[model samples]
Target chain A: MRLRFRQSLDDLKEKLLVMAGMAEQAIQRAIEAYRVRDTSICDLVDRGELAINRLEREIDQMALDLLAMEQPMAIDLRFILAVIKINADLERVGDAARSISDRVRELQAFPVADLPIDIPRMASLAGSMVRKALQAFIEADAQTAETVLSMDDSVDKLNGAAHYTLLTLMKKEPNLTPQALNALMISRSLERVADHATNISEDVIFWVRGADVRHKMGEKPATEKTGTRS
Target chain B: MRLRFRQSLDDLKEKLLVMAGMAEQAIQRAIEAYRVRDTSICDLVDRGELAINRLEREIDQMALDLLAMEQPMAIDLRFILAVIKINADLERVGDAARSISDRVRELQAFPVADLPIDIPRMASLAGSMVRKALQAFIEADAQTAETVLSMDDSVDKLNGAAHYTLLTLMKKEPNLTPQALNALMISRSLERVADHATNISEDVIFWVRGADVRHKMGEKPATEKTGTRS
Candidate 1:
């Protein structure tokens, strides 16, 4: 029975990792769709969303069933709880991708222009954070999780800069308002993706160390030396 | 032992209700702040946010402890899980309030012209949905929960109308782009509040009927006829 429980836990971890991978790919694809104005990529993202949603439900059921059957305690209990939280974050990441894809579709319908800023960099940072957060979970590396958290600040700064720049652009050229607004919305969507990734990293740290590190922006995380910069 | 478990469950429920009330009030106050351009209300919303965050952590701990100690099955298990999910939704509602307050501050700084539509109605709809979701939880009334679900569509329509109006306003008077953007962001924040409330109502339905009615939006909820919808 103990062996079976361990096997189930491992299975749950594997399933979660799979979902994480799918979510990360969806974000990447959505951003690519936006950068290239590739409606085909957006279509792919829209189709891929169903798979992500299904995986979320499956992982949720697995976590709940494990809790009911094994009644995991201590670290094991925290792992399951973190899985539930992270699963929700992953689903929201998928939602962000869908949001971006929708924006891309809208942009396709309108005349396209060369955006004045680098959106792909923002998307890259957000995507990397999502990937690293999952790696932190798989490796149980608190340092990697901390890195994801610190990266969130950079994403927020970029989002603010994008907003300011877009506003200025709109002010100078009224004809560019719609396109600029679409770009701003895309930036916001990417920032939200980074936020979700940070949430997942926070869950990973909590699962590994049993510490609630959320909302403690200034305070040092419990696993500060592992990967945290400040 | 059973009585102790019951008491713990009741305690968790009470704390959640308090948090729900706090979030509902925060949304209402934030809207009032926007309408009156009262910076003090925004400050109050910021101060109240920390308390909401703390309550979220406390309720999370309580729910986890109950699950670990009582090993509740069936309806009891569903109730605890529902509390966990609802706790998250309420925290996010608090976040929506904070976002709205942030927009209020921006509006005060810019002093935009009068809005073209009724924003308070949007706020009232979102707040009432949250309140009704909580009341449904307290009474275990599926009908009330279903009503909240339907109201979400109304909020969505309001958001669409607001978005279109703001877009036209910005186009007609390009100088008002920043102000129009702030108004649009406020509307988006209110829409998010309503979405979270809808999530809470769905959780209530899941708690009562053990049915996953989230993705299956068209079907009538299992407990739809029993309770009065107000």
Candidate 2:
């Protein structure tokens, strides 16, 4: 029974890694769809979303079964719990990709505006954050996860800059409201992707260090609730 | 030992109920702040967020300790797992409240517009959804939880209508872009509050029936993975 449980744990990790790959690819494709204004890439993202959703359910079931049968304790329990939360974050990343694709589809109707927003750059940064966070999870690397936390600030600044730029473009050329809105929405989606990546990294930190570092930044000092061991 | 375990479970339920009250009140005050355009109410929401965050850590620690010490099985284990998820959702609902206040702060800078969007009405509906969902959770009434699911559609429709109206207003009055954007963001925040409520309801359903109804809405049919008993 113990050997079987070990095998199941290994299978769970492998499934999560595959799901992460799909989520990362979907975000890349969604961004490419936005860059080149290709509707076909949007279709691909939609298909990827379906696969991600299916994998999410399967992974969740596997984790729950492990808990039920093995009654995993200590680090094993924490790992399973973290996987559940990371699974949710990855699924939300997929949703972000689909949302970006939806905006791309809307953008297809309008002539591409030469707005001063560097959305491709923002998308690239957010995509790399996702990759790094997932890498941290697979390797249980707290240092990589910590770096992802700092990278989130860059994405936020870029998102704010894009927002201001898009608003200015709308005011300067009121006729471009629809196009500007679509661009603004795409930037917002990328920011959301970045936020999910931050969430994943935080989960990795918690899984590795057993410390809840969430809601700690921009606040006074750290008053962390240390994860107690049994 | 068995009696102590039962008491711990009861304590967990009570703490969650208190936490739910905090989340619901924060949503209500946030909506009221938007309706009255009161920064003071926003401050109250900010304070509520702090308390909610603190309680989240405490409750999570309590739940984790219960899981580690008791190693609960079957329905008891399911209940603890559900509490962890619901606790996370309530914390996110607090975040939605904070985001709404952030928009209100931005809106304070601009003149109020008598736009066609009924944000107060939508906020009221969303607040009620939170209340109903929490009540369902406390009562363990999946029927009430099911009602919360249908209510989500109404909130979604209102959010869509608000988005279109805000965009039209922005185009018609270029000067109103900032104010319109703030209002649009508040509407989106309220919509998120409603989504969190829906998530809580779905969790209640899962806890009661051991069925995962998530991502099952538009699928062929529900293929629930039964909660296997040990």
Candidate 3:
């Protein structure tokens, strides 16, 4: 029974990794859609959302079942609990991806304005944050998760810069407001993706070290939480 | 042991209600800060976040301890699981509140332009959604949870209209870009609160009806997810 339960925990982790992959891919594809101005990839991201949502439900159920059926030790308990929370965060990451694709599609209709924001660069940071957080989880390395936490400052800085640039662009060229507005929203979405990654890393820290570093990760990414970055 | 476990469940529920109250109060206070343009009230919202975050950790830890130590019945297990998810959602509602307060503080510095969006109306709706969803959790009434689900559509529409009005305002008055951009972010944050409320109701439904009505919640509030409501 103990061996079977161990296998079950392993299965749960494997499922989460799958969900994480789908979420990362969605973010990447959505950004690719923006880079190339392709609506077809937006459709793919939309479909990808359905799969991610389905996997989310499945993984959540598996985690709950593990807790109900198996008597896990403290460390194992924390691991399972972390899996549940991380599952939700990953699903939100998928939501962020879908929001980005939606923005990408909207900007497609308007002639692409050369907004002074590097969204793909911001997105890449958020994506790597997700990847590193998951790696921290798989390796059970609190230090690795700590690295993910520190990396969030860079993403938050990028988001702040993007927010300032886009707002300035809107003020200067009112005609570009539509595209700039969408771009701002996309930056916000990527910022949210990074926030989810930060949350995941916090959960990993909790699971591996039994130490909670939430809100302590940094002042809630002032730009992400509060509206006044200016 | 069974009686002890029952008491633990009751304890968990009561603690959640307290956390729920903190989150609900935070949302209302944040909106009031915006309504009155009071920066001091924003300080309250910020401090309130710390309390909410602390409660979240406490409740999550209690749920985990219960699961590890007690042999909860199927229904009881589901109840604990729902509480865990709801705790996370309520924390996010607090986050939305903090975001609103931040925007309010930012907006206060600018000349109050009578933006056409009805933010208080939308916030009241979102707050009531949180209230009703918690009521459903208390009563174990899936129908009450269902009402919260329907209420999300209205909030989503309000968010959509606000998005449109704000974007148009930005286009017409380039000078108002700063205020309008902040307003737009505020509306998005409230929209997220509604989304969080929607998620809590879905968790309540899962608890009471053993249903998974997620993604199936009226097409993911197109505006909240896909961003093409223009």
Candidate 2: residue B224 Cα off by (Å): 15
What does the lDDT come to for candidate 1? 0.82
By summed lDDT, the worst window of 10 consecutive residues in model 1 chain B runs over B221-230
Q: Write the per-residue lDDT of candidate 3 for residues B1-230, one digit (tens) a residue.
A: 66766787899999999999999999999989988899899999999999999999999888877776645554676788899999999999999999999898888778988889888898899999999999999998889999999999998899888888988989999999999888888889988988998899888887876433333535552123122111
DockQ of 2: 0.31
Question: TM-scores of the first chain across all predictions?
Answer: 0.90, 0.90, 0.90
Query: Per-residue alpha-carbon lDDT of model 1 for B1-230, expressed as tens digits?
Result: 77877887899999999999999989988999988899899999998888998998888777776766745654676688789889988988888899889888987767468769678999999999999999999998889999999999999999989877987777778888888888888898898899898988987987776534322423542223111111
Q: What is the TM-score of candidate 2?
A: 0.88
Please give the CA lDDT of all the candidate structures.
0.82, 0.82, 0.86
Best by lDDT: 3
Of the candidates numbered 1 and 2, which has the greater DockQ value? 2
DockQ of each: 0.23, 0.31, 0.27
Candidate 3: list runs displaced more than 4 Å: A211-230, B211-230
**In candidate 2, what are the lDDT values of residues A1-230, reduced to their tens digit?**
67877887889999999999999999999989988899998999999999999999789778776776645655666788788888888887898899899889988877888778888899899999999999999888999999999999999999999888888777777888888887888898898889889988988887777533333423432222123223
Among all windows of 10 consecutive residues in model 3 chain B, the one with the lowest summed lDDT is B221-230
Which tens-of-lDDT digit does each residue in A1-230 have in candidate 3?
67877998999999999999999999999999989999999999999999999999899778767766645665777888899999999999999999999988888778878878898899899999999999999998989999999999998899888888888889989999999999889999998999999999989987876534223425542122121211
